[model samples]
Target chain A: MTLIMVVDDDLDLAEMLGIVLTGAGYEVDLVNRGDEVMPLFSTQNPDLILLDVMLPGLSGVEVCKLIREKSMVPIVMLSAKDDKQDVVAGLEAGADDYMVKPFDPAELVARMKVRLRRSGGEVNSDLTIGNIVIDQIEHSIIRDGRIIALTRLEFDLLVALAKEPGRVFSREELLSQVWGYRPATDTRLVNVHIQRLRSKVEIDPENPAIILTVRGVGYKAGVPGSFQ
Target chain B: MNSPFKAWRTSLVIRVTGTIVLLSIILIYLAGSALYTQISSGIFDEKLNLSISDAQSTARNAQFQLTFSQYQDKAALKSIFAEILAVPPKTFDNTAREVAIFSFAKTKVRFKFSGASNFLEVTSIPKDFRKKTKISNTTQWGRAKLSYINGRNEPAIVVGHTLKIAGAGNYEFYVLFSLEQQTRTMALILNYLWLTGIALTFLIGIITFFVLRRLISPIRDAARVAEELTAGNLELRMDINGEDEIARLGYSFNEMAVALQQQISRLENLSKLQQRFVADVSHELRTPLTTIRMASQVIYSARDIFEPKVARSAELLVSQIERFESLLRDLLEVSRFDAQAAVLEIGEVDLTALVKETIDYVHPSQDRIILLLAPITPVIVDIDPRRIKRILRNLISNAMDHRDGKNIEVQIKESENEVSIGVRDYGLGFTYTDKKLLFERFWRADTSRARSTGGTGLGLSIALEDAKLHQGEIDVWGERGRGAHFVLTIPKFAGGSIRSRPISAQPE
Candidate 1:
């Protein structure tokens, strides 16, 4: 059984989330303060984290950074304010996804399922994009005999692009494919995550080679052997 | 810089200075001419008096000499007459004196002789003056021009007397005094008068310009400070100098600025507090509302195992909770607008697709109640998709509420700089008078009718505000039991103004 960690300052909301997650057949651990997340995180090592933006001891953005420093566990932030600054800050701090307050319980469960599932299970062969090689089975990418680490979300995004090298994926399409979101929603998630992925994988993040951007359309995988 | 004509119209300083200079020029010209005439006439009168007296003494001397010689022989009389005619012409040290003797025109005398002194033309004395001298006896005098044989003329005063020569008949003795000296003096005085007049006029102009500028500077400073204050620099104040009228103006202006700044900051603080209170209330309600929502959903999902009435209660609870959540959301949005904290997340989007998406979201049923009319090509515009979609959803939902089972039409049109979406329905529309109240928060068309759709009553108000945030306008047309049309027009580009409407509110 997959275990999930829930961090929020509101006791009733945390307990309610516990009830919803447990009802969905996932074991749940509820933490009240943002500062208490790491101590429990190291002990339990949950499959995913449901973090709230406002907490007693620390902010959700700081907690997310702490988690990223040590682990690659998927984090989905819960924000009460739908302000761009809060949302973008959480994403920049390495949160995989976020849902505004009062979101549907069914939708939260669906998104958690997508995050927890192992992606690219059917693709047995290695995929080549630019000078990088994507090892689907090992869930990693190698460039010039060096392994590059990526988060699960980033890995899923890359595999989705590398699977069909010739096709261009719009932000909405990628959101639906990788993040399991419906179309015509916030595209900022794709933009922020793409930057993060490039910072980790590309030689120079200023000019990307592996994930080529198509203006007014979306992004696509670069041609093989295109960049020295 | 403004044109001179525009400045004359707008600037008090320019207008006042120009008028003052023009009036001064006219006054100086009039006064200068009057002074010139008085001084010139005074000098001429003095010169004429002196010339007449001098000529009178000389005439008396010549008459006595001629009388004294009359008792002698005719030769002695001739010598006396010759000596009278030999009076010296004008010299540098003496007044210009010329003597001319003429016999009376009707006199019958033995030695009738007409002679003039020293190359002086005998016709130098005007015939009219000679005729007056012949008739008058007491030192007859008039003005004349003394002409020399060399073609030179001089303005002179001619004094005449009748001399009784014993041998010769009555002779007209005239002495001419040249007025050239007096004429030169008048010319010099006129030149001085002209220079003084021009200099005085110029000085008046310069003085008026400087004085007006000095007086208007304080007012100009006040205007500049007022502009700065209006531009939100509330700290600006006028500079005051000595205790004068202008200084009083500065003091009052500063006082007004201080008062205005206080009032504005007070209002700002009051609104800020109000916004903070509203924000806190809404945000504080969200936590428990979320918990209640999830709890209600849990109970709703398990309603099948409960009794019928209890299950129905659970469904109602969930639905009402959803409604409450939506109301809170709308209240927050309205408060944001009131605080002027709303912002746009601008992007380029195909407006036709956006409208279609909203229509489908609002009415997902396949009953074919909503029909969309748009061009084949995509109408791409820079806008906030979320807000535009909200506006469209509100308009379409409103149409559906009063549609009366009739088909609704949603038309999308675009101009070069503007895009508009119009929702038209053939249903129980509102009265024309109710158009103003349509956008009022929580206003209902019919208070007696049941709100079956469970709307929050803030939809249309929020929609109008959202359109306004995009620099757009919402126009409506309606009639009793006829139909309704709501059109929203906005600029196609961000920060652009609407130049033309793609769709009008009045249906054709």
Candidate 2:
């Protein structure tokens, strides 16, 4: 059984979240304070973390950074304010996804499921995009005969671009395909994640070549075997 | 010329100095001319009196000499006349003295002897002056130009007297005194007056300019400080000096600035506090709302195990909670607007695609109700897409509610600087009076009708705020039973203002 850790300062909300996720056939570990997340997280070894932005003792953004320093676990932040600074701050701190308060619980569960799903399947095929090889069987990328670690979402995004080498994916399309979001939702999610992904994979993130951007349109994969 | 005119209009110091200089010029010219006229006329009178007296004494000497002479021949009288005509001529340094003897016209003896000394032209005396001299008994004098036979001219005073001779009868004796000395003196005086007048007028101009500039400098400083303050530099102030009228102005101006700065800072603090309160309220309320939403969903999922009425109650609870959550969101947005704390997240977006998406989101059914009239090409604009989407959603949903099964129209238009989105509905129309209060928070056209529509009562108000955040505007037009139209106009670029609206709210 897959285990998910829910961290929030509000006890009732955390309890309700625990109830909802347990009903969805996932074992749940609930923590109420941001500072207490790491101890429980290390022992429980949950597959995903549901963190709240505003918490006692430590902020969700700080906790997210702390978690990112140690592990690559998927983190989806729950923010009370839909303000851009708050959401971007969480994302910049290495959160995989975020949901504003008063979000639909069914939608929350659906996003959680997407975040926890593994990209590699029985049909494992090696893919190449801009001189970087995506090894589906190993769930890692090989660049210049060296392995590069990537998050599950980043791996899925790379695979989506490599699978269809010629097609351009709009931000909205990428949101729906990779983040499991509804059509025409916030596109900042795609923009921030793309920046984060480039910082890790590209030689110079300022001028990107692996994920080439089509101006005023969308993003597309660079030509295969074009390393330099 | 244009630059001086512009300076005259713009600079107070230049204007005042120019006016003073002009007035001084006129006054100095009048006074200088008056002084020059008085001095010149006095010199001429003094010279005329001396010439008359000197000519009178010379005429008496000649009369005595002719009377006492023992000569009986015309040759001896000719020698006497020759001696008297040998007076010296005038040079640039010396006043000229010339003598001429003329025979009277009615004399019995006809000795036609007329001669002048120092090569003086006998015709130098005007005929009018000669006639006056002949008519008078005593020595008569008038002003004349003494012309020399050598072609030299000098201003002179001529005096004439009648003389009796033994053989030569009724000879007219004349003495011409040159006025070159007097003219030179007058010219010297005139030069002095000119130099003095010009020096005085220039001094007055310089003094007036400096004085006025010194007096107005404080005021100029005050204007500069005021401009700085208006440009949001709150710390600027005028420099105050001693207690005078201008210094008093400085004091008062500085006092006003202090008060203004204090007031502005106080308001800023109050707005900050209000923003903090709004944020706190949002955070506090959202936590509870999240809890309630999850609990309601849990109960809603288990509604099938309960009684039918409880199940229905659970359904209503879930839906109303959703409504409450939306109301909370709108209230927070309104509060943000009230505190002037709303920020724009600008991005390039396809306006046509956004509108189509909003229409689909609002009305998912295939009723063919919304008719979109737009350019076939995509219309891209820089805007805060979330706010724009909210505004469009409010307008479209409001239309859906009041459309009354009539066809709705959504039109997009673009100009050089602005873009307009117009949503029109032909349904149960509102009165003209309702348009005035349509955007007011919690204001409804018909309370009973609006209550049934399940609107949050803050939709239009928040929509107006959202439009304002983008520096845009919303216009509404409605008439009784004739449907309503709403139009939103915004700039195509961030930080730009709408110059012309592409779509008007008025129906054709």
Candidate 3:
């Protein structure tokens, strides 16, 4: 069974979320405080985390950074604020996705399902973009015979762009393709994640060669040896 | 800074000073002319009196000398006349004197003499004065010019007298007194008068200007302080110096400023408190509302096992919760605007695509009701997409509420620096009087009628605010029994202004 950790300051909201997640056929572990997340996370090893932004003793963004230090587990932040500062801060702290309060439960389940999905049945293929090689079977990328780690969402984003090298994927398209969002929803997710991915994978994050941005349109994967 | 002439229109100091200086100039001119006339006439009369008395004495001496020489022969007489003609000319100590002697036409003398002293022309005296002298007994005096043989002339007073001799007929003797000294004195007096008049007038002007400026500086300070206060600098106050009328004015002005600042800050604190309450209420309600919504959704999903009435009630519960959530969201947005905490997340977007998406989102039934007329190519704009989308949604939803089975048209057009989105409906239109109140919060055209859509009554008001945040304007036109049209125009770039609107709210 897939176990998901729900961290929220409100006990009722946490319990409600547990009920919802349990009903969605996922094993749920409820944690009311952000500080208690790490000890249980180390032992239980949950497949995903649903963290709230405002928490006692530890902020959700700070917890997100702490979690990123140890693992690349999928983190979807739950925030009461739709403010760009709060959302972007959570994203920059290594949250893979976020949902504002009063979000649809069905949509939340759909997003969690996408995050928990594994590519076990697909044929293993090697994809090349810019000067990097993506190993589907190993779930990693290699540059100059060295492996680099990526978050699950980042890997999915790069795979989406690499699968169609000639196509320019708009922000809306990327949001729907990788984040399981409806078309024409929040594009800031795509933008922030792309920046994070470039910083981690590119030789110079300022001038990205792997993710080439098309002005007024979208982004695309760079061909091998495109840059000198 | 205003121009001098323009300041004359707006500044009290300049106008008052100019008026006082001009009146002083006229007053000085009148006083100076009156003084000059009185002093000049007095000096001329004194010089005339002296000339008349001196000529009387000299005429008497000449008559006495001629009487004694009346018994002499022709040679003796000639010597006597020569001595008289050879009298020493006047020096500086004496007034300039010249004499002329002529025989009357009635004289029956053997020797008819006509001679002058010092080459003085005999015709220097006026013929009218000579005629009066010839007929008069006492000395006849008049003003004349003493002309010399060298063509030089001097203004003088001439006194004519008749002379009697024993052996000679009656002779006419005239004496001329020069007026050059008196003329120079009068000119000097005039120069002094002019200097004094000019100096006094300038002094009066300068004094008036300084006094007015001294008196007006406080008012000017009050004006400046008032302007600063009006510009939102509530701390400024007039500077008071003394317990005079101006100081009283300053006191009153400062007191008013203090009162105003207190009132403003009080109102500000109250408004802040109210916004805080609203925000807190919204936030506090959100968590519980979220829990309740999930619980209701859980119940709604299992409604198949319940009775029909319970199922229907569960369905209504879920839908009402959704509506309540949207209302809470809108209330928060309004409070954010009230607190001035709303900020834009600007991006470049395809406006045509955004409109199409909104049209499909709002009325997705696909009955071909909403017709969109836009450019085939993309109309790209820089804006906050969420706010723009909300505005479009509100307008379209509003149209759908009042559309009344008519076709609704959404048009997009662009100009050089601006773009417009116009939503028009031919339905239960509003009256012309309601146009002003269209964007007002909670305002409905006909309050008696039931609302056809699920709206929080803050849509149009929030839409106007959202448009204003982007430096945009929404134009509306409506007529009873006709239709309603709303047009929103915004700039193409962030921080830009709408120079021209691509569409008007009025229908063709």
- In order, the TM-score of chain B in each prediction is 0.84, 0.86, 0.82
Order candidates by DockQ, high to low: 2, 1, 3
What root-mean-square deviation over C-alphas does model 3 reach? 4.8
DockQ of 1: 0.70
TM-score of each: 0.87, 0.90, 0.81
Quote the positional error of residue A53 for candidate 1 in Å: 1.0
For TM-score, the strongest prediction is: 2
TM-score of chain B of 3: 0.82
Candidate 3 lDDT by residue in tens digits, A26-74: 9999998889989989999999999999899899999999999999999
Candidate 3 residue spans exceeding 4 A from truth? A83-85, A113-178, A183-228, B71-97, B100-154, B159-173, B196-218, B236-252, B302-308, B335-357, B364-384, B411-420, B432-437, B440-450, B468-473, B489-504
- Considering chain A alone, what is the TM-score of candidate 1? 0.98
Question: Compared with the true structure, what per-residue lDDT tens digits does model 2 show for residues B289-336?
Answer: 988998999999999999999999999999899889988988999999
Write the residue-wise lDDT of candidate 2 on A54-166 in tens digits: 98989999999999888888999999888789999999989999999988999999999899888748757788998899899888899889988777888888888888998
Candidate DockQ scores, in order: 0.70, 0.80, 0.60
lDDT of 1 by residue, A60-177 (tens): 9999999999988899999888777999999999999999888888989999999999984777999988899999899889999999888899989998898899799988899999
Clashes of 2: 0
- Which CAPRI tier for candidate 1? medium
Lowest summed lDDT over 10 consecutive residues: which window, candidate 1 chain B? B68-77
Q: How many Å off is the CA of B249 in candidate 2?
A: 4.1
